[model samples]
Target chain A: MKFDFNNNIPIYIQIVEQIKTDIVAGKFKPGERLPSVRDFANETKVNPNTMQKALVELEESGLVFTERTNGKFITHDTSLINFYKQKYAEELTLTYLKRMYDIGYSLGEISKQIEQLGGNK
Target chain B: MNTILELKNLNKSFGAKKVLENINLTIPRGKIVGLLGKNGTGKSTLIKLINDLLTPTSGEVLINGKSPSVESKKIIAYLPERTYLDKSMKVAQVIKYFAEFYDNFDSQKAYKLLEELGLDVNQKLAKMSKGMQEKVQLVLVMSRKADLYILDEPLGGVDPATREYILDTILSNFNEGASVIISTHLINDIERILDDVIFINDGKIILHSECDKLRTEQGGSVDEIFRRMFRC
Candidate 1:
């Protein structure tokens, strides 16, 4: 997974987001071995410890699972994937609504705008 | 929260320099304790004494109602300011050694962590950079589901991003009913996560209070109160 070091977010967070994106995008197929922490760290030029943290977060969130001696693999649970997708989608929508509301957009106006822009995606 | 560790009138001095004095503290189980102190204020010394790496010159320490001993060592997972590891050993070897010594050691967790860290069991510790070595040490320490985890300067001298990751590791890991005591002057980053704090100055515990109560009652951050109490 590619990392943007200069991003305003923390590197571990960036790593977490990237890995989740990969899982969501099917770049990491179910049961596929995730990259070794050292390889990921070396590739990103970040500390292995930092990389490990991202994986731990992923594991905690049920996006990945680890098998001793074998290695870490992407979780194959379709419901779990949908769970995260819906969770993040709702969060982003709420955040966008908040931002728009802060700029004086009413709830009705925002809802109307979403309906107009909904088909393109 | 059971009393996991207690210190009574603890005092320490090196030559003419007094590092800590009249330090009394009781660490309860299942809380994140933040030990705040500036450089040379004896934060590390306090941890060393608890781990029995250094004998306290004065006062008493009790782990599970007895003096710190081999049995107590079995229960505590200590991460020192300096990495105390055999650099010659491979990452897998150290985990095995820890597992052998500590019956509570979880091999599956260790292997899973190594996999997550992307560390090969065959990789030599000496070959890794200092930062990698630090990660290895942390992974080993955290892999254990110990009762009391003592971390000294867990984020010292690391890049900001790595520091964030280290903090996350501390937060995400550890077992239930296990208390984690992190000693560091980096108050701003860890203030939010700490359940309680003990501020040390000249080897004495000048302030001891719950972080939330202190904030709510005093209407200030731990760092602000720390600066006020420590102001020269």
Candidate 2:
């Protein structure tokens, strides 16, 4: 729950991104109940308002839902979760490729290097 | 009222010197606002005016749409820049004193916080270090069920680790819909918790903005913006 926040960016947006990563990575199980905004804010060491905004953003994206007095819960849709996972992987891959290209490495060379690293793993 | 506090054409002076000038601001409920500035930049003066500690030369200081009076004072918990507890009183005695003095003061919550901080209730104020005393003050202030909490430099004397604890205490405590106004020169440490920020310089408010919008527009942290704006 520790956040090494970048102050240059909006704190709530960072919270949304981190929580989204956690959800997609299975740290927060599908259909799991989330903590109250206050408890979440305390855990993340952020303002409750900021945490509320982040949760609302998550809800808007259909990753979370409110059940009236029962509080918030993660969506049980495995397909939605998988979709986000794929989307995030694509984003990371594109970023890596862009950086490699900027450093004068071709896509072929980058793939070879990644394969070598993966083989060692 | 929706607005917890407001200032209209606020001005203050001391003889020939103008300490605060033509200031106007409004604070809504359920917000944590940072009143930030360099030393002697009217931050304290603005806070003092809100607390009725000093009279503004003109304009008005409104708390819940009323002037600073006994009614407003009851709902506004104030932690001044300096410690004013009786030096001879033990921590427990001070809690008792505060309980008797302020109706909203929660002695049990105060004791719990003190225990968590590992501060002995029997310890006298003079026996504790300056940082420890400040922690005690913060615990007491946050223990109160006040509508608006005005903390002046609560993190000034504490170390970095203690600063985190202090910020946590502030974030966890406080009644819902209550606003907190924290004045500090240590911008980076407190900026994350602030919903809005008021930047003052040379007796005037240079900027007041939501922290996220300001970050997006200025392309930096509030600390960086402050440093750039106030650079000599």
Most lDDT-accurate candidate = 2
Q: Estimate, for each residue in B30-148, the C-alpha lDDT of model 2 and write its tens digit.
A: 99999999999899989999999999999999999999999998999999999999989999999999999999999999999999998999999999999999999999999999999
Winner by TM-score: 2
* lDDT tens digits by residue: candidate 1, B74-156: 89999988876788888878888988988888888878776776668788889987777777788888988899999888777
Report the error of model 2 at residue A82, Å. 1.0
* Model 1: number of backbone collisions: 6
Query: DockQ of each model against the real complex?
Result: 0.04, 0.85
Q: Give the root-mean-square deviation of each candidate in angstroms.
A: 10.0, 1.5
Worst 10 residues of 2 chain A by lDDT: A112-121
User: Which interface RMSD values do the candidates have, in the order shown?
Assistant: 10.7, 0.7
Q: What is the TM-score of chain A alone in each candidate?
A: 0.82, 0.96
**What is residue B120's positional error in candidate 1, in angstroms?**
3.6
lDDT on C-alpha atoms for all candidate structures: 0.80, 0.94
